[model samples]
Target: MMFEENPPSSYLTRAAHSEDSQETITAVSHVLQDQENTRPVPADNSKSFAASGDLPAKPISPQQRLARLRLLMSRQKAEYESKIASLEQRHRELQWEIRDTHWQLGQQRQRHRLAEMRIRDAERAKEDAERRNEMLQKEMEEFFETFGEINRWK
Candidate 1:
């Protein structure tokens, strides 16, 4: 519709730098829509709005269009910043969760090491107990043999 009203030269000059992305297309559409929404100077070339709309037109010159676009851009920028702040907060929360998980893993490793040491010490103690029992059995057998031989001689 804009191409139909405005000459190819006017629109093409502005659109020359735009690419095919949807966002870029949408932004261009918004500018085109904004420019078209203004009242065309009354065919008689008078500056008054009495001929058509109840309110005076918003953009009459290149400067006016620039100002209007600046205002729109500023508003969009503020919205983007607010959304970014929320994302940044989420990022920080994720980082904290990562730290907590790492700490828990460290604690698990320490507990595992302690359990291994206790098991090793228990095995050594068990070996020592077995050796002491074997020695006691040998000494008791020797005492019984000696006492039995003495009783027999008497």
Candidate 2:
């Protein structure tokens, strides 16, 4: 009923006059076929349609197909570029973390060395203190023995 009112030729005529007519028509046909179960009118009726100052439906052109292919390639390129940038950023962050870890390890090694030195010094000081205590105990025993002998004589 809708085709009877506006006619299929009128749609093709408009499509033929557009810059990217073939692509537009194909897109419209696909949409119509999907949404309303409609089929594009064939080009075999061009003679009759032309006689009535209209055009007939034609297939998509090579130029239009190439344009769609180019568009798809560009989108894929953009997606890959985005992924590469993210990976590079992650790599940089990982490098910084590794550097920080190395620094911390160096600091810990230095602290361990200092603590070892302090422990060695403490051991030496304790040995010296023990030797002095032994000497003082011997001197006190000799003094007490001499005092006991003098008391016995008195």
Candidate 3:
């Protein structure tokens, strides 16, 4: 588990500011541009094999090659489907995790709100107590003054 003190934007800024990363990005862009300029050569039956001066050996008939291509394509399609299914499963898991995190955050917010309310109530109670104490002190002072006058008259 990793504890992150800073927010996501800071990490993004750090990544964007790296000089080595910029050079790497430029290199990758150039490589991709070169790839865009390159084209695949079509299969030519008349082309001579590079290793041998003779024509390229035809391993299978046209029909057999077509069947092979179909099989390969189907295999690739199935592989892609499996990959997609796994990716979808992972996406669902991530979504559930996000939902759970949001729920936890909501619960925390509710708890914090409740705590704030309790604190406010406590503060009000403290004020009321202080006011009551002051009133009692004033009453005690008045009682003492009345008792002193009565004693003086006696």
Candidate 4:
């Protein structure tokens, strides 16, 4: 009677004004369905709705709820900030360790190269010494042969 000949607009206004009995029933049913689908928020006790904190177990005013939500958000933000700081510190440490490792590896490789060069030089010197010894032995044999010939003539 109030919305004579304007059924759709009347339904929309009723839904908006929270006046329709059918809309209220549907809303309540949907809420129940959602509750059935959801896992319970961990409560201190089965009867209490509060989590494991000092917050109220029963429903509070809207202002108190808003304050609690803000506190939870701030706590989460602080935790994220702490985690990021720790990760950054660890990143810097790892970078320094990598650089140190690289430097040490380079020095070790240089020392190894120098040792190889020294070994090559020592091997060459040994070969030269062996060749000189062979040449001296040949000279000594020739001298002895010539001395024997000279003594025979004498």
What TM-score do all the candidates reach, one by one?
0.53, 0.53, 0.57, 0.58
- Cα deviation of 117, candidate 2, in Å: 1.4
Model 3 earns a TM-score of: 0.57
lDDT of each: 0.69, 0.68, 0.64, 0.65
Tens digit of per-residue lDDT, candidate 1, span 1-154: 2233443334444555666555444444556565567647556535565545466456455455446656755665686788899999999999999999999999999999999999999999999999999999999999999999999999
Deviating ranges (above 4 Å) for candidate 1: 1-72
Steric clash pairs (candidate 4): none
What's each prediction's clash count?
A: 0, 0, 0, 0
lDDT of 4 by residue, 1-154 (tens): 1222332333334556786667844543443344334546654475563444554545444455335435644665687788899999999999999999999999999999999999999999999999999999999999999999999999
Tens digits of per-residue lDDT for model 3, 12-90: 3454577776553443344333433453544763453564345335444435433543564566568778989999999
| Pairs of residues at least 3 apart in sequence or in different chains that clash in candidate 3 | none
Candidate 3: residue 133 lDDT (0-100)? 99
lDDT of 4 at 28: 38
Clashing pairs in 1: none
Once superposed on the true structure, which residue ranges of model 2 sit more than 4 Å away at CA? 1-59, 150-154
Per TM-score, the best of the predicted structures is 4
Q: Considering TM-score, which of the candidate structures 1 and 4 is the better prediction for this target? A: 4
* Candidate 3 lDDT (Cα, 0 to 1): 0.64
User: Model 2 over residues 9-45: C-alpha lDDT tens digits?
Assistant: 4444566678986656674464333423344655777
lDDT, candidate 4, equals 0.65
